[model samples]
Target: MAKLLVVGAGFAGAVHARELANAGHQVDVIDKRDHIAGNCFDYVHDCGVRIHRYGPHLFHTSNDRVVGWLSQFTGWLPYEHQVVALLDDGRKVPLPVNLDTINAVFGTRLETADDAMSYLASVALPRSPVISAEDHLYSTIGKELTDLFFRPYTKKMWQLDLSEMDAAVVRRLQIRTDRDPRYFRSDTFQALPTDGYTRAFERILDHDRISVRLTTSFSQDDMAGYDACFNSMPIDEFYEFDLGELPYRSIRFHVSHHLAATAEGLATINYTDAGPYTRETWWHALPGHRVHETSNVLRTIEEPCCYRENSLERYYPIKDRDLMYQSLYERYAARAATDDQMFFIGRCGTYQYLDMHQVINQSLVHVSKWIARS
Candidate 1:
């Protein structure tokens, strides 16, 4: 048995620590935050309502292995996530610009899929090389729809121009002519944890061979006794911003409670109008909660902002194809490749926009390869 160190008790760290511990290794997991589950952490308020402390995290994945592995720790509720956009005119329509959304927004009676596709083709500009997010969206859906929905919301979320962002950032946009209003329609498994994300992580870490340390920080000097170290901290930060700081966008969540039973019908609504906040989420609408008239409903407004060091939580790594950032990440990656004891994993470590399933799958794959090599 080997002693190992896992940093950052998010999905990546928890999954890796669990797998490593099960494989006859003594693992110690550390997180800078006081809680587990990282950004997916949730807590029940005094109002008898459970709200995502960071923001709404919807788990929807197509990978059977990842689902099967996580299912052992927590049961799931059959939940297909949906999103609606509050247009500039105060009209709420289904997101992903479906047939109903088009009809409602444009005041046109497009009855069939063909009608919607034809209308889009007529309005779409000439297809250009899809490089930036702006180009990809304009080529796929056209400028009018992009301007109506994505422009303002994306600008506020990323705090950058669309042209400056990588196309991979908005590659997940599901532009459909059908009537499906679900955000993740292609996913095979779509649900929230039966309990909450924090409990799920606690279950994952509940092993005799595993020890957890919260509000603790670890560095290379702490890896002397450990056989291996799986680091989930930002790669640039780990290297002390040697090449330069990689850009990341953080959020400020304004959570409030209302006596009303329902605020927004769905879980989340993106505001297309100019506002400080990008979107608002209703917490009671999530799983493991029953709506009540007297029960206070929790609403969270997500305001995206520039990331400040040691002040706020970093959520999304800025996906600008900036030459300097790319070069810096490559330099740090090369350095990690040479360090046999240190392994970088997760969104911040790799500086990629990743969903929950992707993080788990990546950790599983990486750990499997590490075990084989060891």
Candidate 2:
């Protein structure tokens, strides 16, 4: 059997390690963090609530294959995530700017989906070439709602003006006329792992042919023994920034334990004001998270900053309207292609924004292709 090395121990690495091990390969998985599950890592708080260490990660995917594969490792608890934007006026409206959100903001008594669509169309200022996030938002939801809800939040989360960001960033959010409070309306399935993300990772990595090492940093020199390496380290870091740096946004999490039953009325609250904080999540609000029987709850407040500010912990890769960062990533990707024995495989490796399911799906496809060629 070939000896393979999988770096990061996140969804991408875990999936690769598991798949290769099952294919009769000896796999060794390594992660810089002490724990597995990457950003989806969660632990039971003292109060019995499961707190997501990095931030809240809601698993929602339309791919049945992904769901089926993950189901083999962990059972799921049905959870459709909901978010509300706390307006400056202390009014909480459903996010994605739905029918109720429009009525709440504009004091309109519109009943049907057509009424909401008509109202938005009347106010929307159509742009011929929508390139920037600001242009897309203005054209879809108009200036009033865009400025009220997105402008402040975007500025804080990305540390960039809406006009400077790529349209794809804002395009992820849907403007629905229906009063569907669910965050991932288009996804066919949405849920959390029955036990926890960490538990699921534990199950995934538990194999006779697989071994895992945590708190282990990866280096190019470590690639000596392994026949093949699936790397999830930042592409720029792997190349030591020979082609300059690729910008990424990271979050500073301020977690606190409160003696309350619930911190926020909803699981998550997006701050629409121009504050240092972007959003806050209450751990107890998530389904199947309240494993303990205590009145205390865990609340995590997030503040976005440059990746360098957060000890170089890269989270979201920055994308600009001019595709400047994308162009730089392409250069690094081209260089990565030169190494036949190594493959870059995760969000940082690929330099793109990917959801949990997308990361899992990517690794699945990558490993399957490699197996076929081998």
Candidate 3:
């Protein structure tokens, strides 16, 4: 059996380690953080509320393979995430610009899906070839709604104007004619683990053939001992940034405790004003997170900043209309290709804004191919 090393105890590394170990390979997993689950890490607070250390992570995916695989470690709790955008006029409207949201915003008492579609079309500024996020938003919802909902949020989130960013950045969000208030509409499976995320990670990495080390950092020199390495470290850091730095946006979270039963009625609230803060999440609002005996609430507010400014804690990789960062990532990926033993996986390694299911799917595919080749 081959000895393999998996860096970063996130989904990518945990999936690889588990799969390899099941195949009779000896796997060692290491994470710089003291715990597993990466950004999905959560723990119960003193007041009995479960707090997601990073931000709120809602698991929603259409891939059956992903759902089937993760089900082995933990049972599922059905949770459809909902978000409301807090407008400047102190009005909360459903996000993704749905039928209800449109009526509420413009005081148009439209009823059917066709009515909503007609309304949007009347206001939309058609752009033949949309290249930037501003263009996409304008073409879909027009300048008024775009400025009211997206422009300021995008500015705070990416620290860049909408016109400067790629269209793909905003394309993930859907503008629905139906009054579907759920954040993720297309996903077949939208739920959280029955237990906490940390417990699920514990079960995933509990194989006899696999061992994990927490509060440990991975170095290039450590690669000499293992036959193969599945690394989730930042690709630029792995290469020591020889080709220069790739830009990433990070969040500085400020969590506060309240003696109330709930903060807002919704689980998440997006700020539409030109403030430093972007969004806030109410921990107790989520299913499987509320404690019956406790009357306290934990709210986390997010402020976006550069990864460098946030002590190198990278969350979202910045993608611009110019594609400069993508080109830089390609250079690093080319260098990674030369090392046959080293494989880069996860958001930081691939330099893409990936969801939890996408990361798991990628690791599953990669490990299967690697095992077959071996």
Candidate 4:
């Protein structure tokens, strides 16, 4: 059996560890944070409510294979999220800015769907060869809608002007013309682990062949003993930022509590305006088997802060020519190529945004490669 060292206990690292160990290989995993699940970590709140430590990870994917693999660890709970956007005038409307939402939001000239769609199409800027986030919205929906729905909310969310951000950042999440209120694009239905995200991770981290080192960091010397290393930590940190440390964005959550017989219809509501907060969620808002009582144990919270963090923990990659992560990546790419045995995985490892399923799929894919040699 091969010896594998996986740095970071997030989805990517955990997946790698599980895959290698399941095949009778020795796998050692470490995370400086002392947690099994990195960004998706969750715990019981003061009121005995299970809450996400790093905001919320509503697991949504169109990938069936990813869903099937995770089924081994946790049972699925069908949940399709509904997003509510707080307009500039303090009105709440459905997301994707659909025809119904458009009519409700504008509450004026855009009364009919045809009129709204036609207006949007007419105002859309001419297509551009190279598109930024600003250009994506302007080209697709028009400048007015982009300014209203995207510009201010984006400034509040990322702390940088949309004009400065990368086009890929806003290119993905789209506005569907249909009335599907479900926010996530999961294959059939969106699902969160029944017990909790943490419990599911515990199973993955507890494999007999997989040794876990929590609240600890991994180094080159630590990696030397292993036959191969799959690092899920930041790429820059792996290289000690030879070019420069890249900037990342993170949010701070302000939580509040109230004893209520019931909660609002939605599990989450988006406050796009400049209200010292970006989004709010009630733990028991989503109608299903909740981990806590609806009354006296619900958490209502606000997340704010729009700038890139100085620390190494990357929330969102600052994709711009200023940092030129691509250029720096080329340097990292060169180093990684030389190692031959070390493989970088995960958001920070590959320096790309990944959904929950994407991380798991990454590990599953790695298993195939790991098993091939045996």
Question: Any idea what lDDT model 1 has?
Answer: 0.86
Which wins on lDDT, candidate 1 or candidate 4? 1
Per-residue lDDT tens digits of candidate 4, residues 83-130? 888776777888867766766655544545567667667778966774
Model 1: per-residue lDDT, tens digit, 144-220?
78888888888788666777888887888777899998998899899989888899999999999999999998777
Please give the distance, in angstroms, between residue 78's alpha carbon in candidate 4 and its true position after superposition. 0.4
For candidate 3, give the lDDT of residue 238: 87
In angstroms, give how far residue 350 of model 2 lies from its true place.
0.8
Greater TM-score among 1 and 2 belongs to 2
RMSD per candidate (Å) reads 2.0, 1.5, 1.5, 2.8
* Model 2 misplacement above 4 A: 127-131, 166-168
What lDDT would each prediction earn against the true structure? Answer: 0.86, 0.91, 0.91, 0.75
Question: Please, what are the lDDT tens digits per residue for candidate 3 over residues 133-251?
Answer: 98998998898889988889888987789988788888987888999998888899999887789899999999999999999999878878799999999999988889999888999
Model 2 is weakest, by summed lDDT over 10 consecutive residues, at 257-266
Range of the 10 consecutive residues with the lowest summed lDDT in candidate 3: 258-267
Residue 40 in model 4: lDDT: 91
Greater lDDT among 2 and 4 belongs to 2
